[model samples]
Target: MKAAIFKGPGAVEVGERPEPVIQEPTDAVVRVVLGCVCGSDLWYFRGESPHAAGSIGHEFIGIVEQAGANVRSVRLGDLVVAPFIYSDMTCPHCRNGSTISCPAGGSFGNGTIDGGQGQAVRVPQAGGTLVRVPGSGHSDEVLRSLLALSDVMSTGQHAAVMAGVKEGDTVAVVGDGAVGLCAVLAARRLGAERVIALSRNPARQKVASEFGATDIIEARGDEAVQAVLELTGGTGADAALECVGTGQSIATAAAIARPGSVIGIVGVPHGEVPFTGTFFRNIGWRGGPAPARVYIPGLLDDVLDGTINPGLVFDYETDLDHIADAYRAMDERRAIKSLVRVGGI
Candidate 1:
């Protein structure tokens, strides 16, 4: 089989690799149907978080080729979606609906297990980690949309949920990346009356509008704060969803939020949250790596039922052999997200 190997920063190649096999009774060997490069994957691509040569990918939707004896929830030929993080659903955190907090869980493409950017992957905790992709067969668009349930959509939804978006509330989303756009959609879906998106690109601003952003702020810092305050009648947003992890973005979120509001840091934080400023303003903080495992099921239903079409975020599509190009497209901001057909499905 051929798989993507992260040899070093800025170097990902498709090369021959060993086929996956069931390594545990809770495992399932899945023949990947679709996989995609994540924004977080850029951390490895840029050498920010270095990794020795190994298979690398995390978001995937596939068909179960085989399952071990202990895997009871999924079976042969079942189309499944594997969240970015894998977990045993029976663990205390999982049972309580916090799968990412599961003590028995780990990442999908941390290199010990087969990564999703390949022909097949060995899924640990298969019964708990795999969510059946709904239909026996699905159209390409439907499948693409369902793929978002694995991570992007789940994380966006997590940001909104953690920020405490409520009906009639004004919500501001920081960042214009795919996750931020998805956060806008998630906020609207959760009933926020007005979603203010901080976007600089016209294209992304259009997408944000489609996803329910009633207003778009194109400035940063104090100008951006004034924009939000002006939009909300000088009160500021009821909650702010911080989708970018930079120190500046974090401060922007805090600045645009109303007093007594929560700022959800959905983006993987790259710097320390400014404490003195946030503390003095009485702005609450929450959100981290999303518990995608717990959020996938309901989001899957929304995808299948046509309530949301997050696949629109995937602006470029390619095959496994062109995985490097997919990575480059995302790295260069040429694509909001790239979707790859793993086994030509």
Candidate 2:
């Protein structure tokens, strides 16, 4: 087997790894068809966050090569999507809509477990962690979109849902990364009449527009906040979504949200939130790691039917051999997202 190895900050290499096999009766071994570099991975690549020196990707869709005796939800030869984290869907936290906190859950590609970046992965709790695609012979475009459901799309939808976006509500998304762009789509899907995307990149702005953004603000910090406020007639956005975890982005989201509004924050926080200011303004916040397992089932139909094409976010494509290039493209900002074709269906 072969996979991407995270040697250290600024270093990722393609190398041979032991083939994954069923480790428990509840496990399944998946032959990866497609994998993608996530924005969150950049945090490790840039040395801004810590990552172990081994298998290191978390988003992928593949075909089940082997299923354990206890894995009844999916069987061999079934195409499936593995969320970034593996959770026991029966756990109390999962039942409460917080799969990320499932007592028996754990993240993939955290150094010990075989990651989706590999040719195959040993999926623990496969019955609860893997979402089987309903049909076969899915087109390339559709497969890419399916891969997005493993993380970005679900995370984006979580932000919108947490913020209580409603029909005719004005929404402002602060971030133009793949997740942010998907947040725009999620807001529209939830019936938001107006979506303002904060982005300075022309390519991202185009995608945001296609995803249902009604406005694109080419400003940051105070300027961006003012622009969102002016667009909302000085009342500020009915709901502000923070898709970047930086201090500036958090502050911008807080500033642009209307008083008494709740801001949805899904970005991996890298800075402190302005609790005092938001409290004083009657602004609340809600959001964390998206329970992708919960959202995947709801979003799958949309992808299969082409109601949305979140795969448009993958601007760069590569194979497992050049895994390093996949990381570099996203790290250098040359691609919004990098899709890695791992194996055939």
Candidate 3:
């Protein structure tokens, strides 16, 4: 088997590794069909993530190659989406829709489990973590979209949902990366009347519009704030999604929303959140590493039904042998998202 590993800053390598097998009764082996790099992976690729140099991907969809005796929710030959983290669905936290906080949950490539960007990998808590899509086979396009359900789309939806986006509420998405663009789509799907996307890149702005962004702000800082405020008729957006995970983006979310609005942080925050006026303004802050397992089931239906095309975010695809280029494509911003085909599932 071959899997991606973090070598150092600006480096990733695809190399051979031992094949994974059912190591526990709760485990299942997944034959990864499609996998994509994530923005969070940038933290590692750029030497920004503290813990690097491990198996390096977490978002993917695959076919069930084998299931442990205790796993019952899926069986051999089932197509499934594996969220970024593995959690026992039976846990109280998962039952209440917080699988990310499940006591026994853990992320892939975190030293305990191999990451998903490989030919095959072992999945823990298979019954609770893997969402079995209804079908036998699907198109490459559909598979790519279903792959988004594992993380990118689900994370974007979580940001909107946490921000309390309502039928008439305005949404300001503070980033133009794949997650942020998907946030625009998610906000609209949830019925937001307006979606303001903060992006200076012409390409991203275009995709943001296609995804449902009603407005685009090309400025940054207070200038961006004023733009969002003016666009919303001076009241500001009802909710803002900070999808870049930078202090500046978070600040924009804090400054661009109306008082008493919610600001969701879906980006993996890199620095301290400036809790200054944000605390005094009664502006609620919500969302963190999304509980992707909880959101995938419903998002799966949308993808399967063709109601959304979040996969548009993926602009590059390659086989596992070219995985290094996949990382470079994302790091250089050559592609909004890069997909790695593991096998012909």
Candidate 4:
């Protein structure tokens, strides 16, 4: 078998690796059908992530080739989506709908767990972590949307939920990456009356509109903050989703939110936030590792029913052998997200 391996910063290669087998009673060996590079993957590739060399992917969808004796929710031949984090559903946090932070859960691609960017992956807690896809024959578009259910889509939904978006509320989203674009869709699906997106990228602006952004703000710095405020009358948005983790983006989210509104930040923050400014304005902030495991089931239904189409975020596609190219494209900002076909249905 072949897997994407990270040798060092700015380095990823498709190298021969051991095939996965069911190692636990609750595990399932999945024949990966589709996998993609995540923004987080860039962190490791750029040497910014703390984890050392290991398998390089987490977002994926696949067909179950085999399952351990205790696996009950899924079986052979089932097509499923695996969350980036694997969790035993019975844990207290999982039961409370915070599976991503499950006390026993851990990431799948850190060399401790077989990563999803391979021909096959052994998924622990299969019964709780895998969401089965409904049909036999799914188009590329459908598969792409289903893939989003694994992480980005659910994370975006979490951002909106945490931000307190409500029916008739005006919402603003900071950043135009895949998560931000998906946040636009999530806000729309959640019933925000007006969706305002802050982006200067033409490609992202187009996708944001398709996802239901009623307004696009192309300004930066104070101009961008003023633009969002102007769009929502004299007040800032009722809620704001911060999809970028930079200090500047965090401030932008806080600056563009109404006095009593909340800012949901989903980006992996790299530095300290300016809490003093946020405290003075009375703007609440919430969000961390998105409990994508908790939202997958409900969002899967929406994907199957055509309520949303987030696969549109995958603007580039390639084979697993070309995984390096995919990373380069995303690193260069030439692609919103890249999909890699690891195997077949």
Candidate 5:
């Protein structure tokens, strides 16, 4: 077997590794068909995320090669999508629709959770964590879109939901990365009348439009704030989403949110949130680790029915042998998202 191992910061190598096997009654082994690089994965690659030499990847779609004795929702030959985090699905947190924070769920890789960026990987709590793809043969578009359900798409959807976006509401999204772009689409799917995206990248701006954004602000800080306000007729957006995990992005989200409006932040914040004036303005904040596992089922139906094509975010694709290039393309912003085809399902 072959997997991409993180050697250190700014480094990754494709090397031979032992294949995974079912280790728990609730576990299942998957033969990875397609995987993609995530924005969060960059943190580990840049030495910003806490990790060591280990399998790297979380968002993936694959075929079930084997299932544990207790697994029932999925079986051999079923194509499924695995969320970045694994949960037992019966825990209180999972039952309440917060599977990502499931008291029993843990992250993949890092020697605790099995990482998915490889030829094959083991998934725990398979019955609850893996969503079976509905059909047998899927086009590239369907496959890629289904793969997005594993993480970025669901994360984006969670961001919008947290922000309280409603029908006819004006929604502004900060950041135009894969997650951010997906947020733009999610806002539309959720019935937002006007979607405002803050991004200077022309490539991303184009995609934002396709995803239903009515406006694109190519500025940041005060200038960006004014742009969003101008679009909202002197008022800020009714809801705003912060998809970038940085101090500046958070500030911008807060600045562009209408007084008493909500700002849903999904970015893994590494810095302190500036709460100055937030309380006095009556602004509300809601967001945390996106429970992607909870949203996969409904989102999958949309993908299968052609209601949405979030896979448009993937502008680059390659096989596992060129996995390092996939990381560099994303790191350099040359690609909105990169998909790696490890094998066929």
Candidate 6:
């Protein structure tokens, strides 16, 4: 099998890896049809974060090629979406809506695991981890959107869910990456009447607008905060979704949220949250890596129904053999998100 290999900072290569097979009674081997480079993947690509030197990538949608005896929810030939992480939905944490914290759960493409970037992946806890796509003959556009449900879309929804976004609420999103853009869509989907997206990139701004951003602020730091506040008539947003984990991004989120609202944070934290500042304003914060497995089902329906086209975030595309180019495009910001076509349906 061919897959993306992490060769340390600033280096990603397309190389051969062992093809995956069913490893457990509950396991399923999925032949990947679509995979994409995540913003978080850049952290390691840039040496800002640590990643093992093997299979890398976590977002993918595919057809089940093989399934162990215990894998009943998904069978061979079924198209499925694998959440970024694998978890037993029966765990206490998963049942409580925190699959990321499931004691038995772990992420894919983490060096030892069969990553989604490969031709196939061995999915553990297949029954709980893989969501089968209901219909067949999905178009390329729809398949790309289905891949988004594996991570970004679900993560964006998590931010909205954590921030308590609701009907008639005004929301502010602090990031313009794919997840942030999806956050804009999620806010609107959750009935937010006004969505303020903080972004300086014209392309992203366009997508944000298309995704239902009622306002676009092209400022940064305190200026961005002021802009959001001004848009809300100085009362600040009813909710703030933090999709970037930088100190400035966190501060901006804290500053722009209304006193009684909560901020949903899904970005991998590279900086600390302003606890004191938020606490003083009676604001709250919640969120982490999205429990994608839990959100995929509902989001899938929307993707299949054309209610949301989150796949628009993927402006760049490549095949498994050119996986390195996919990573570079994203790292250079030449593409908002890079989609890697792995195999045929």
Q: List, residue by residue over 1-345, the lDDT tens digit for candidate 4.
A: 899988898989998878888888988999999999898888878777776676868899999999999999988999999998889989888998888778778887887777878888889888888988887888888899999878899899999999988899899999899999999999999999999999999999999999999999999878999888888887999998999899889888888998988899999886567788878888888998888888888888888888999999999999999999999999989999999988878
Model 5 steric clash pairs: 109-113
lDDT at position 184, candidate 6 = 99
Best by lDDT: 2
| Global local distance difference test of model 4 | 0.89
Against the true structure, what is each candidate's TM-score?
0.97, 0.99, 0.97, 0.98, 0.98, 0.99
lDDT of 5 by residue, 204-226 (tens): 99999999999999999889999
- Residue 336, model 5: lDDT of 94
Clashes of each: 0, 0, 0, 0, 1, 0
Candidate 6 clash total?
0
Instruction: Kindly list the per-residue Cα lDDT of model 1 for residues 235-327, writing each as its tens digit.
Output: 888989999899889888988889889898888888778878878889989998888888888888888888888887898989999999999
Q: Residue 45 of model 3: what lDDT? A: 81
Residues forming the 10-long window of minimal summed lDDT in candidate 2: 88-97
Listing every candidate in turn, what is its Cα RMSD in Å to the true structure after a full C-alpha superposition?
Answer: 1.2, 0.8, 1.2, 1.0, 1.1, 0.8
TM-score (C-alpha) between model 1 and the true structure: 0.97
What value does the lDDT take at residue 108 in candidate 4? 78
Clashing pairs in 3: none
Report how far off residue 205 is in candidate 1 (Å): 1.3
lDDT of 6 by residue, 131-219 (tens): 99998889988999999999999999999999999999999999999999999999999999999999999999999999999999999
Q: Model 2, range 1-345, lDDT digits (tens) per residue?
A: 999999999999998899998989999999999999999999899998889999989999999999999999998999999999899899888889899998888998998898888899999999999999998888999999999999999999999999999999999999999999999999999999999999999999999999999999999999998888889989999899999999999999999999999999998777889999999999999999999999998889999988999998999999999989999999989999999999999
* Model 2, TM vs. native: 0.99
